[model samples]
Every structure is written in structure tokens, then in C-alpha cells.
Target: MRPVASVSFDDLLRAHQGMIRAFLRRLCRNDALADDLAQDAFLIAHQRLGDLRDTGAAKSWLFQIAYNVYAGHARKHARRRELFEAQNGADLDDAAQPAPAGMARDIAMAMDQLPADVRACVLMCLSYGMSHSEASKASGLPLGTVKSHIKRGTEKLRAFLHAYQQA
Candidate 1:
């Protein structure tokens, strides 16, 4: 693996940043988060550019790095979600504040009703814009399981929201 020259690395980063960010956004569904991951991926690639011998493979190399970043972020989110559940997320903050009297609070309250796995799948697939396969990969579930979770979760959310609106 030969190190990419600084000048070449600069050009590579410029040319590929948008593409990497777009790919990450498809997986993450959050533009800000996707952009952050893209920056991290580029930084890592710059640090490891010397280890890569094939400049022609730059695009693939950068994408591989981006995937690694996304996977790592998924694992971290899972851990945090577990910790939040264990500690009771409400006890941390959402509980301490008086519930805002509005749709936001209603939605949040409704979201709290969802089972953790279902919620995770919904956020990843529907809210975040991840494809079903990508959500399955991130959630470490079977493809069928991911699909099932999303289907059931959305139905529940729909019902919950409808009830809230009626109230």
C-alpha cells in the first residue's frame, strides 16, 4: 500500500465527499449525522492513504471506510439504547421535564409505547431512510424479522397517533 500524496488526497476528498455523504445518508437517514460520518470516513482515509497501494481503488476504499464507520455507529447506538432502557430514559431528562402539551409530546409518548426492537427498526427504515436490507444489517436481525418489526411497529404507531389526534 503506497501512501497517496497530500495533493492527490485533497482532490480525492473533494471529489468523493458528496458521494460518500449521499451513500451514508441513505443508510442513516439523517443528513447531519451522515455528514459527520462522511467527514470521519475521509479523515480515516487520509490517515491510512499510505496503506492503500491502489489509487485506482480510491472510491471503493473510501466507501469501505464509510461502511465501517456506519457499522460502528450502529453498534454504539445499540449500546446506548440498551443503557437508556436499563436506566429508564425518562429518569434522565424526558421524564424530568413537564410533558410539553402538544403534538411533539404526544408523539414522543406514543413512541415510548413501541417495543425497543420495533422502534429501532422503524427509526432506521422509515424515519431514517434506510432500505430494509440496510436496516436489517444495522440492526443485526434477519431480513424477515426486520420487515416484520417495521410492519407491526408502524401499525401500532398509526393507531397510537390516531388516538392521540382524537384526544
Candidate 2:
């Protein structure tokens, strides 16, 4: 088979752009950041195109790279936030937003409290309608782990929403 690098990078961008953006949005929870990450992902993919083995696996491979980029960005920003908070002695709610109605926002807030890996599994399975196996592949987690995370994440979200309603 011909090398993927031999193909037009623009064609790859056009094909996988939406998936990359959605993946980044879920990871970063910010549309602007997601857009920036999506562009970066495509650039990285283009640069590494020759490394891609299976054309059929290109979508998943691209998503994996995007996930890694978002995870690294999140970790770096988290450290920055800690430093800023230490310097200012004031908590910054960079993520604060007007709560949406009903149970959805409550559920999302609960999901936000989860560990990153668990949250990614939950979002991939519930929000994006991925199967456990698909989520496993996308997240680089085992299928059983993906299922467990979804089950626990759902239970936690439900409990959180119930508590919110009681409040």
C-alpha cells in the first residue's frame, strides 16, 4: 500500500476534522481550546502520516493522538492553576459557568469530579454513544475497565443529581 504521507494532508483534515474537534471538546470542555487542539492534531497527524500503518485505523489513531495532546495540556494547565492560586491566595474558577437546567448539568458536574480516565470513559460511552469496546480502543483502556467506569460514573451522576434535587 502507498504511504499515507503520499496523500493530501488537506484530504485527511477534511475527513477527520469533526471527530477530532468533538474528541478535544470533551477532553478540554472549551470550544476554543478544542478548535486549537483539533488544528494541532491535524498538523501532528500530517507530520506523522508515514507512521500510520492501517488506513482503516487512521481515524482511531488520530483520536488517540488528540487525546494525548489534550491530556498533556490539561496536566500543564492544572499545574499552572495551582501555581496561580498559590501566588494569589485566591481560587480562580476558570471553569465556572451558569448552570444549565435540570439534570444534565448536575450530571456533567458530577462527571467533572471524576478522575480524568474515568471521566473520559464515561463521556465516550454516554455522551458520544460509543460502545464499551470502542471506548476502550479510543481511550486505550481495557473493555472491562471502560464498562466499570461507565457503570460507576452513571451511578455517581445519578446520586449527585438526586442530591441536587433534594437541595
Candidate 3:
């Protein structure tokens, strides 16, 4: 990987855009929002390109930015959802919404049950094939915390899937 100062924005975007979008889609389970957030992430990356010190770590750095974007959106959405529910005297649970008809509802629900940090760590490591160190960097979590999250997250996923299989 070339240094950040040497790499073109187009090249970085071309290399990472799809993976970033896919990761966001899995996190949010919303295609449009994921696409929008992916764009937002790229924009942020472009602005911060000068800050990148090690080009070899670009992927983890990009994931970090993307994860931050998703986290910010999740926080904003949760607050708005809470206020809306309070005003309407109603409760709404995003996670309780059924998966798309043909999707694996059990897996989706299980993943949704994870806290955001845990899910992000698990997905970064398992879904994206990132190393533990990379996942740690991407999630901005300590290395041990990232490993612990992956262990706990996978356990929950396995138990959930096993129960689903039995039913």
C-alpha cells in the first residue's frame, strides 16, 4: 500500500467502497442508508487522508471511519426513535422487525441482538476476514476487548443458530 499522500482518492475509493458499503448494509440492514453512510465515510476519508500515517493500515483506518459513521447514525436514530415513541405513546423496536422474506431471519435476529461494538467486532473479523488486530483497530476497541467481543458474539450466534435449527 502506498502512503496516504501518494494514493489517489479514486484509487482508495475503488479499492474499498464495496466492502465498506457491504459492511454498513450488514450493520444497518438497510441498503439505502448503508449506501448513504458509505458515501459519508468516503467523504470523511477523503478529508482525513492527510492524517493517515501508515498506508499498510489503510483498510483498518477506513473501516474505523465507516464504523464511526454508522455509530453516529445509530445514536441519532435511537434518540429520534425514542422521542417519537414517547410522543405517540407507542413502542417500536427496530430489531423486532422481521427480516426480508427470503433472508435468514434467525441469523439476522441473532446478529441484531449483539451490542453494536460486539457485532462490529464479530463482523469485522468473521465477515470481512480481518485479523484480531485489524478488527481492534477498525472498531477502536482494545485488542483484548475485540477478541473477547468476537468470542462472546460468536457464542451467542452459535447458540441462536443451533436453537433455530432445532425448531
TM-score of each: 0.47, 0.70, 0.82
What is every candidate's alpha-carbon RMSD to the true fold?
A: 8.1, 4.0, 3.1
* Tens digits of lDDT, candidate 2, 1-167: 44555566677788879877876765566677788878887888878987787666676677777877877777778877688899987534335334567676766566668877888887777776667877788778888988998899889888887888799
The residue-level lDDT of candidate 2 at 16 comes to 78
Higher-ranked by lDDT: 1 or 3: 3
lDDT of 1: 0.71
Per-residue lDDT of candidate 3, residues 93-164 (tens digit)? 443333555337667768878987898998899988899999988877899999999999999998877877
lDDT of each: 0.71, 0.74, 0.84
| Pairs clashing within candidate 2 | none
